[model samples]
Target chain A: DVKVTQSSRYLVKRTGEKVFLECVQDMDHENMFWYRQDPGLGLRLIYFSYDVKMKEKGDIPEGYSVSREKKERFSLILESASTNQTSMYLCATDPGDSRYEQYFGPGTRLTVT
Target chain B: AQSVTQPDIHITVSEGASLELRCNYSYGATPYLFWYVQSPGQGLQLLLKYFSGDTLVQGIKGFEAEFKRSQSSFNLRKPSVHWSDAAEYFCAVRGYQKVTFGTGTKLQVIP
Candidate 1:
């Protein structure tokens, strides 16, 4: 079975503090994505990585950035966390096959005070 | 531009009652449709997908969705709803490398 794991399940940080959310997938997939979930707004993509050291901004990438240093791990970084950035963060990976199905991680809920 | 819509924001159904969740999409060409379920504090789980033929696609947890090209809709249905089925359901559409998700419908199962 394919599994995606996030470093933290819940996190609380002060506003302006730097935050790091880590995601690792064991499926050896080529594509990884970061999304933030908010009530009523649903899931909005923050960033995505198609290969190691390659990243692209998604729909709502304003206050977020990403790094893909290795094939199995992708990291989401918040240069300066803010209250508005509080959200449930999700990580997903696509198997690169034409199907384009994404497997997701358990999610990290971040609360910026 | 491709987009996905889940008109109903929230749905409430009694346990064991039949349920249907609507999803509509707008894409230029053939789309890859998917239905995912997210429990509280958990990630989204793939419930079903529709890529091509066989309009009616069966999924895990006794859930099924049908793709209708004429209607541009892929609606999910279940014969019976369980309390555990109460969660946020998302419908997504893939075009090339990008996937667009619906706003999501939060299901509430009444005992």
Candidate 2:
């Protein structure tokens, strides 16, 4: 079965702490995306990669960086976790669909204090 | 820029009751739309999508969505909702390069 897995379901970190959220997709999709979901803002794209070691910033990429060293994995990095950075992070991969239908991970809810 | 909108913030329905969640979008060209369900803390699961062809699209978990280009809407529907259907539903539209999602509508199914 096609699958997208995240490193954590829930995490808590203090302000100024660096954080890493990992996403791995079993399907060898060409494009990967990172999104931040807020209470009323839906999901905002943070970063996306069409290939390994290549990345593009999305609507909200500030305070967040992404790395894609492997075709199967993508990582989101927070330079310093702040209270405003607390949100649910979602990772998705496109199965090369022309319309860009995405497969998503379970998501990681990060809490910064 | 293209965008999607879900007007309802929340809706509650009884088990076995019919359900409909409204979604609308704004795009210059033929829009690619999607409906996704998020269960509690889990990620969003694709319920259905509409690119072209039939305006009415069937999806997983007995869900369906209809695309109305005239109205710029893609509304999700179910004949009968189950208790397990309680979740947040999001409508999305694929713009030129990226997909923009609506804030979402939270569904609550009660017995």
Candidate 3:
């Protein structure tokens, strides 16, 4: 069984604050992803890391960045959190060999006030 | 670009009734398809996935999905519904390095 753990389940931050969401996977998957889920928008990718120190921007990467200093950990950073950035953030990991089924974390519901 | 569409936004079914959720995709070739379930305030769980082999695939929780090449649809089905089956279902299509998810369908199981 693969386990993906997120640092926080819920968080609250003021506007213009810097926020960090951490994710760790025990499976040592090669690909890690960060996504924000909205009611009508589904899961939109914010950023993804294929390897250590390698990152790519997903569809919506505007105020967000990612860090993958190690193979087992991936972190998502919000440079300047805004009210619009409040969302349910999910972290997922996928082994490159698997058929693209990603294991997800419990998600962090961030509230930017 | 790859995309997935879930037509139904909300569905209501009684316990022991049949269940079906519609999903469609747009891509050049046969892409990886997946169905996920998310409980309230929880993360998404993989129910089933269709990679390459057979058109019909079985997943966890007595759920199954069939891939139709002609229709470009991968619809999920269950023989009988349970109260615990109430959740949000998302259909996803995965390309080489990208995965596109649907808006999801909320299922309500009536007593």
Candidate 4:
């Protein structure tokens, strides 16, 4: 079975706090993605990495960054957490084929105060 | 450029009634289409996907979606709805390299 796990299922951070969200996949996939879900905005891509040490910005990458030091692990970092950044963050991994579907983690609900 | 759209922000259906969620996309050619369901606090689950071959595709939870190239749409449908089916559904399209997601449609199944 394919499994994707996140470091935290729920998180709370104060303003100006540095937040780190970790994601790990056992599928050995080369592509990983990070997205945030809001009330009506749906899932907006934050960042994605094709392979280790490679990253690409998505439509909404402001105030967010990503790290892919290892093939199975991808991390999303927030330099400074804000109230507006409070949302459900999801991590996903692709099977390296554009025609294939992506596997997702349980997601982290972050509350920034 | 490639984009996906889900016209309905919210939909309500009875537990035993039929359900349909609409999705549309715009691209040079038919892109890889997918439908995902997100529970209240869970990750997005892939309902179904359509790349080529058959236009109608069946998915988990007895859900299905049809691909209409002429209409540029891939609408998800289910013959009967269940209370457990109340969740947010997202439509996604993958182009050459990256995947683009629609705003999403929220489904509310009533008992």
**Candidate topping DockQ:** 4
In model 3, where do residues sit more than 4 Å from their true spots?
Answer: none
Residues B9-38, model 2: lDDT tens digits: 999999999999999899999999999999
**iRMS of each prediction:** 1.0, 1.3, 1.1, 0.9
Can you list the residue pairs that collide in candidate 1? none
Model 2 per-residue lDDT at A36: 94
Worst 10 residues of 3 chain B by lDDT: B92-101
Fnat values, one per model, are 0.66, 0.75, 0.68, 0.82
Q: After the best TM-score superposition of candidate 2, give how far the Cα of residue B42 lies from its true spot, in angstroms.
A: 1.4
Candidate 1 residues A25-76, lDDT tens each? 9989999999998899888989998899999999999988898999999999
What lDDT does candidate 2 reach at residue A113? 94
The reply for model 4, stretches above 4 Å from the true place, is none
Positional deviation of residue A93's Cα in model 3 after best superposition, in angstroms: 0.2
Better of 2 and 4 by TM-score: 4
Task: Residues A8-89, candidate 2: write the lDDT tens digits.
Answer: 9999999999999999998799889999999889999999898899998999999999999999999999999999999999
Model 2 per-residue lDDT at B32: 91
Ranking by lDDT, best first? 3, 1, 4, 2
Q: Global CA lDDT of candidate 1, please?
A: 0.94
Tell me the number of clashing residue pairs for each predicted model: 0, 0, 0, 0
Error of 2 at A35 (Å): 0.8
lDDT tens digits, residues A1-113, model 4? 78999999999999999999999999899899999988878888899999899999998999999999999999999999999999999999987898889999999999998
* Ranking, TM-score, top scorer first: 3, 1, 4, 2
